[model samples]
Target: MEAALTGSLLSLSNNLDTQAKAAQKDSQALRNISYGILASDKPSDFRESLDNVKSGLEYTTQYNQQFIDTLKEIEKNENVDLSKEIDKVKAANNRINESLRLVNQLSNALKNGSSGTAEATKLLDQLSKLDSSLSSFRDYVKKDLNSSLVSISQRIMDELNKGQTALSNVQSKLNTIDQVINSGQAILKNGKTRIDRLQTVLPSIEQQYISAVKNAQANFPKVKSDVAKAANFVRNDLPQLEQRLTNATASVNKNLPTLLNGYDQAVGLLNKNQPQAKKALSDLADFAQNKLPDVEKDLKKANKIFKKLDKDDAVDKLIDTLKNDLKKQAGIIANPINKKTVDVFPVKDYGSGMTPFYTALSVWVGALLMVSLLTVDNKHKSLESVLTTRQVFLGKAGFFIMLGMLQALIVSVGDLLILKAGVESPVLFVLITIFCSIIFNSIVYTCVSLLGNPGKAIAIVLLVLQIAGGGGTFPIQTTPQFFQNISPYLPFTYAIDSLRETVGGIVPEILITKLIILTLFGIGFFVVGLILKPVTDPLMKRVSEKVDQSNVTE
Candidate 1:
């Protein structure tokens, strides 16, 4: 029993250590992502990062609660020291029997005519001592140990209950937020549809106005000629005819130009304002269709997390933050700008902003393809005779890194030659792409090497996340909170940022920072691969064996 108890403790301890390490890794990822958020100019990204932080906190809380539960179970276990209690009871029984035997000896001595002897007195004293010892043992069990156990158990239960209550409160708040988002989205969707229809018919309406003005101008000459002939026929009132004719001609000149000029001005104003109106409507639609839904999804995720946690100030704070951000976003969408006029400097290349994003995406996609096609392990060699796991990982990593660099070169050079990306610093552009490739390949390679097929799935998921959250295409702030929160953790964010710097015009400090971040990401994933491969390899092997067995059965 003791051995089993010790083993359970050891297993729990190991589980805790693993959980702690996982949490630490998550913390570092969150920190890195937070930094990415700070670097971003978009509010959407910042809000999204906050959501990720909340999720991490909730997970950490659940882990801590698991530790608490383990401790509580250990404390509440009545059988934990049952063996010790049995041993105490047995010692007391032996003493009681010895006392009874001594009493019998005294009786036998009295019957044998030795009642006044020292032996009888000694037996009485021994009996007295045994009685005292048994009483002490009984008191220890009933009074001291029992009370202590009860007190410990009660304390653990009290704390656990408190935690559960806190979590429940947080869950309720999140549900409320979800409902609010749903309502807001429905309202915005209707508004966007209406705006779209209005924009679609606006050009036809303008054309009708132009046709009416032109027809009026074409008939004005005949009306003036008819009036002049009337004045010639009315020679009896020459002065009045001259005055009337002058007045009529003056009215035509004034009214015709006014109508034509008004039409031209209206057309010009509509042409200038149409794009801004469309942009405002698009922004609102994006918020309703994309941003709000994402926020709600994140809230639901957070709600799931809170379901496992205790009610605490942290949960309250998280809910409040989410609510405030959602309210702000609602306001922005509701009060969208119809037209905004601002002075701006125009860049020669309109695509410069997006070039970095596409370049990074191409390089990442290339690495993903490379890893998917290639095997990380050598199947020919027996497991015992093969290279160390680290060696296999590093070896495969080196090959993938080279391939990634080549892919980067091909894509980057192609962008310059064919796409005319008009990169300001061609050398820096290629260098950034190479660095991005290394980072992307490292992440994909690490996953595949350590986790096998499941790792590949994770890599694919990561790619999808980065594409959405990386701020590569649209501003991260313009995206949903979940993507915004995850963008900083994604390598694509730094890669694209660095690429954009190279394409637009490099800021040496910013460029250096981005490059350093990308390098860290590569190093971080490589380290994860090194640490987790040995641990996960056996599991993967077991799964493979299970699959093979199932296939044979089929």
Candidate 2:
């Protein structure tokens, strides 16, 4: 458990580090783009953008410098031979700097749109080639880092296992002494003296545990610090490193249209200088083919290293050591470690909370509605004789709607019980219930309408969609934007949102609007079913007749 948690934390920390660095790079790029788009003069804008590119280049240079420092530190402490990796990183950093310089020259070509149109075009092609090369270089660095981290983790785990075995031995002896005393075994006076002797050895055992724990803690932080320092070194010293990689990627991704527009403008500006522009493009293509593969390999190495570090056990061992020590402290209740982050998230209060009640009510109401409809309609040759289509629609709709509404109420009531009617507003709970009711009605009605036969299939689909898309464990916003857009269309979305707000103090920003939209959709569908009742009956009849005809044909 400790190892797994440590792995998770390490992964999160690594990802966070990546995101932070990426964010910083993106920020610099954004500033550059913003300044370029809003410069007082055309020349000034070009100048600012060039400066931005320069800053990025400088950052990358600093990152490389730091990487060198970390390599030196690692060599000194771990006796690891990282000369090859260090040299590769340094060389790549130098090339990246050269690329940035070329990119800056291209960026400076703005008189109105592009001053050095032919030159800028040539530079872009050169930068693209440079970009690919740098990517490969980074990959290699990342891989080396991973191998180093894996080595470190294994060492830490070995230390922890040794400590645990030593502690367990001490504990077993202490327990034996206690059992002897409790049994009133006076003949075991020598055993009692032996137990006293064991006390003298306790301190040594303690030293071993402390040494292991301290070593793990100190070493884990150092490894992380090294990774950070290395990242900063490359990022700070080599402005071109990130500019050619992340900034370029983001700009290309988020503003392809803008890039194309600017590209066309530059081409037009250099119409008189077409030969220079074409030559630049050809040179860039050639460079990409020749150099990018090596750079890409390097980047892959670096990324692999990053992932290994993120999964290392040094930190996890330290945490476990602390926990075990606390457990060993007799007569004192240990404070529990907060593993909430490691646990499943968007946490539902299922065990002793009103949430379970709400969950139960919703399921029960759905089940009852389904069963009632199936059983009621089972014996009928013509339910139409006793009821008009509109009446049938109204009766069925009313029954289900009531069931949905009541289920929502039951869930709300359960929430109240679990929360003990806390200080949080009950209004949110009510809203959740209402939203849930609407969602259930729409979903049930839709499934019944579509399936024609109501049984286990509709229930399964509803449950699966609810679990996956209902925002139970993870917010739909983190999902694909397509799902983010579509989740609100799901009934469970509102139920989770509103209930979360009421019970968990997670009031949604757009709850009112979402509820209104959901309510409208629910009402609209229900009304549509009413108007289309005659149509549905005839369709059902036709379907039955077709089935009977098939039977006859058979």
Give candidate 1's whole-model lDDT.
0.66
What does candidate 1's lDDT look like per residue over 1-554, in tens digits?
22333344444445544544444454454444434433444423334443454455455446545545434434333224334433454455455445445544544544455532344355446645654664565465455544544544444334334544433443454445434444768757655653443244223333433444454555557545654654454555656768999999999998998899999999999999999999999999989998999999999998977875555666577567767799766765787576777624223476766788888888878987887788877665676466877777678889999989999999999888888877878998887788888888998888888877788889888878888988977889999898888888888888888888877777889989988988998899899889888888788889878988888633
Q: Looking at model 2, report the run of 10 residues with the lowest lDDT sum.
A: 197-206
Off by over 4 Å in 2: 1-387, 418-423, 426-431, 449-451, 454-462, 477-485, 506-509, 545-554
Q: What lDDT tens digits, residue by residue, belong to model 2 across residues 1-554?
A: 23442353244324423433443353345344534444434444465656655676667667666656555554543356768757776776666566566655556555346545455445555555655655565455356544554554455345455754544444454445434435547536545543443243223334444676654553455445555655665567556665778888887789999889999999888896888989999999988998788799999998888787668965567567767886544323453353445432244434323452345346436744664455313245576577766666566666666667776676667556765544255766665666566556655564465335542366566566656666666666777676677676666666555555555455456667656666776677666766765676567667767877887632
RMSD of each: 44.1, 40.4
Model 2 TM-score, all chains together: 0.32
Best by TM-score: 1
The count of backbone overlaps in candidate 1 is: 8
In terms of lDDT, model 2 sits at 0.57
